[model samples]
Target chain A: MTDTTEAFRLVVVSAGVSDPSSTRMLADRLTSRVVAAAKERGRETTVTVVDLRELLPELPTALSSQLLGPRFQRAVDALSEADGVIAAAPVYKAGASGLFTSFFQVLDNDLLIGRPVALAATAGTARHALVVDEEMRSLFAYLRALPVPTSLFASTEDWADDALNGRLDRAAHELVLLMESGFARAVRNESWKRYQHTFGSDAGRELGIDTDTDLMRLAAGGSLVDSEDPFDPRTA
Target chain B: MQFGIMSVSDITRDPVSGYTPSEAERIDAIVKIAKHAEEVGLDVFAIGEHHNPPFFSSSPTTLLAHIAAITERLILTTSTTLITTNDPVRLAEEYAMLQHLSKGRMDLMLGRGNTAPVYPWFGQDIRQGLHLALENYNLLHRLWREDVVDWEGKFRTSLQGFTSTPRPLDDVPPFVWHGSIRTPEIAEQAAYYGNGYFANNIFWPKEHYRRLIDYYRKRFEHYGHGTGKQAIVGLGGQAFIAKSSQEAHAQFRPYFDEAPVYGNGPAMEDFEEMTPLSVGSPQEVIDKTLTFREAFGDYQRQLFLMDHAGLPLKTVLEQLDLLGEHVVPVLRKELEAKRDPEAPANPPSHADLVKAKYGDDEPRQPRPNANRGDNVTGGSPYQDSEAEVSAYPTL
Candidate 1:
């Protein structure tokens, strides 16, 4: 438990607006794989699930306002705060859904830097399945997130296929190994892990940081200046 | 040079342990799988949305946003963003927001999904899915490229001088790939606008996709996007590999034997006989995939489906290791060597285009008057002719 908590947090974030969707099914399979693999390694783990549907109606508006609003600061605080995330969506268009994507645009930049992610998608048939790899993987790469190699794709047929269950189990084991590798080889890397969030202290007024010098130092990853009252909103 | 991975969120029993992973577990799988995709040098990770039972991904953009938070250099796109079912206005705003978050590493595939039940769920008529796709995409295209839009259509409410924000990254909207397995109309749509065409080649034989790809390429040339060979293409594939062919087949056979699609009447072997799903050794998978170019021409993207058999996470990870260390490198090298210099290297990147369009400058000044007839450069029909405006009702 100590190692798992200290090692990295795992988050499975899915936006399945449907009651029974291939996207949700695939997400479940992958999660089981990761959990099982972790257990096999005797590594204790904690998992969190944030269903975008629960946030819906308000999701689009909240994501939009949080991204474009003056107070957009609160947007994506959780994403920026997490160590690992599993992002899933049902394929719409030739890409991700507009709602699913808006949540990302509002996030602070440092949030995704060098973090690990698993990508999953669902479609009606097996035909458009490649869109996951051809499009979503590239999106993550650009954001500097470390995505896993094996992506899961499901079609309507997968629902009844007992074989799909086997695939999900394999995927779970695979993910645990990959995450373990990520934790062991790269988790503690400063280049990869040091920066979790960034406050453009220079946007002091905008972000509410006070001292320009202190903001710059903070941005540079240096200690802040010693002040009589460091926590004061005004100044020390 | 395009790469990606997709998830179909299905809650099912684990083949080995008979344990059904919860919806939360499935969602978490995407995060880990996406990370592995990046680590192994894949290019994109996309999610699909469905509004029915057992399928969980109802909102792809939300999932994509989370993916954007954890990856770099992996282009995030969707397999099917049901252009027919979703509103253009909401879709516009969502993708625009993604463009900003991913620094333009986002793009999408538009399709009319197979499920008919989704139409009523989203207040759409299944019969009108194609029409709605064409109409909505037209509006979405303009919304991403145009600043202010004033229009009305059959399926959607009128937009009275609406502006979706935060304006696509650097004024360049995410590139689109119109994907279809059976619809020729989509191929024409993709070609008409010079966007990419994606044929998910999982079902049917190579000849089926060849026709679609050929049709798209021909129309693309007709539309003057470039030569027929320069038309963008992407393909879909499935795999279940182990060290040896026998071992891999032995392990995956049961899952395939029980696959909902492959189970019962057709049998797993029969289903594989009809589609590109490969349940064999890594070499066999690679070899089978290499034969794709013979049918689809020089495509830009290739994605594989590996995590579907309910094989548990351990087996899935081993497969990833094989793909990263053996399969992908081989594919990458072979694919690169086969490229034609004149062909588009990859999809048009928004970041590069943004930089090219707005170099060393703040975001382009909002061109309030730039599209006026006096300044129009014949780029749009609405520029000089108010008659073109009549096609759509005024907001």
Candidate 2:
């Protein structure tokens, strides 16, 4: 599939806190290869990295009062504009780190519907290898995001393995194809009204106001009585 | 440019003193606060209605009526009166009675009380809140404007020939303001009926409310209320003032840290930056408040959140002294000078309403034919009605 547009927007969300953290490395690997894969298909791409560490200070206020601080607002704007996404989180205990899960959780539902996301996770041991598929995939699924089938996992041992690079290539190729498929663009452009969106949700993008509804009819000083079942106060 | 105080009616503990005002004490103190607001030359005093604890103002009309009797010229109102849970018929009756009792010194701001449990307490579902708010206001709007309303809607039972009584002061219904933070439907509804739109510009960022306000203004003009710039608008913000910026911060910090709903969450500075909360000197408050006019445009009312978070009555009164003595007077002159001549200088009072309905003529005084047992009259209840025949043939 080929897009007539000049460049695809690819966003990477990384929950890795420290410099050169494995979680971030896994996301970067996907990011670089996705750019390469898009080039192979003759498509240019622009990448934006949303470091969860930079979002940490704003998360509390966002959760508490639904007020997006500058950082969260920027992240939401970036995520909403992405043509494809790469979400990479570190494993803490058995689940994704709270920072990673929280960043996704705070986003309004339907914000990412139909967008292709490539999932990746890193942990200290091989026991954490299943975190991407078993844990992180479900979260993306709940967000209505389409996760590429080749979920990337990197334990310390797997990082040096050639198989890890193979999964990255496959995922990157899959993401580029999904982006070219124009499914997410179609959903946003065509079928967006079919979804139930709260006013001001989706980073304030869902603003279509239909004045023909019953509620709107009533709001405009119209009577609530329908002709089919008109209420006759005199009869009652 | 009407200046006032709008409280959540919170009974929060003094984080610094470790004492919570009893409901009785807080309720008693609220009247004093409203009276003091008038004494300090503030123009209006509004309270909220809440069924849950930590909030004492369950019945706002009662409180406002009492304040109306004791004070003169200070407009009494609610930060919001729940239009969703309470029967709008009852709202029409009660606020109309308050309107008459206060001698046209009162008004209404309606909200869809979305506190989930409170909805069920009134036999309503929170999910249907917007529908209820819309349909109920559709009915409430008529209840005030029309002598009798025959209506049926999804949420409430059908009403036939129902006349909410006392019939409004001077045949003029109290003005209504539709309050919302984010809901476009609420804004649209306000525009649809040409009602005043009140944005509780306290928590969210200024741009957030700014966008909604602009939308409301555009829709208001679309609905033929007025030009976009002349549409009636009100703002509810939070502010704390002292003579010096340092004193203001030092006095308000503990209250901010432990305030209900947002305490222990974001730092005060961050909240102030994100929201329109002004905490500083009177000049600082005026400077911050002046920006609201720039952002929201020429508008009618500006109400502040000053009494919540359990600041003792003494401190609250003192804050009022500073606000009255130093703040609102200057705000009045500055905002007055900047106000567009075409935009309304104040929200419609009962006198303005009476005049609108009947200019230089006597207002309609409803003389009831008879009660007809439970207000179900065969024809129009008032002498002014010229139906000439009953919709139902009399027995």
Error of 1 at B328 (Å): 0.8
Task: Please state the error at residue B54 of candidate 2 in Å.
Answer: 1.3
lDDT tens digits, residue span A92-177, model 1: 86676665665555454545666678888877878877977888888777666777776766778877888767766665665565
DockQ of 1: 0.01
DockQ for all candidate structures vs. native = 0.01, 0.47
Shift of residue B90 alpha carbon in model 1, Å: 1.0
Q: What number of clashing residue pairs does each candidate have, in the order they appear?
A: 162, 0
**First chain of candidate 2, TM-score:** 0.89
Candidate 2 clashes between residue pairs 3 or more apart in a chain or in different chains: none
> What's the lDDT for candidate 1?
0.68
What shift in Å separates residue A112 of candidate 2 from its native position after superposition?
2.2
Docking class of 1: incorrect
Q: Chain A TM-score, candidate 1?
A: 0.69
Task: Report the lDDT of model 2 for residue A87.
Answer: 95
- Cα lDDT tens digits, model 1, B1-395, are 77666656555566667877777887787678877888888888877778875667888888888888899888888887989889988889999888788878889988888688778888887776766777788788889887567776556777766767667776777889888864556777788788988877765545545766787888789878789989989888888878888888788877766554444333445445556777777788778778887667778888776666465766667777887787877877787788787777677777666775678677653433243433223233333333333334558
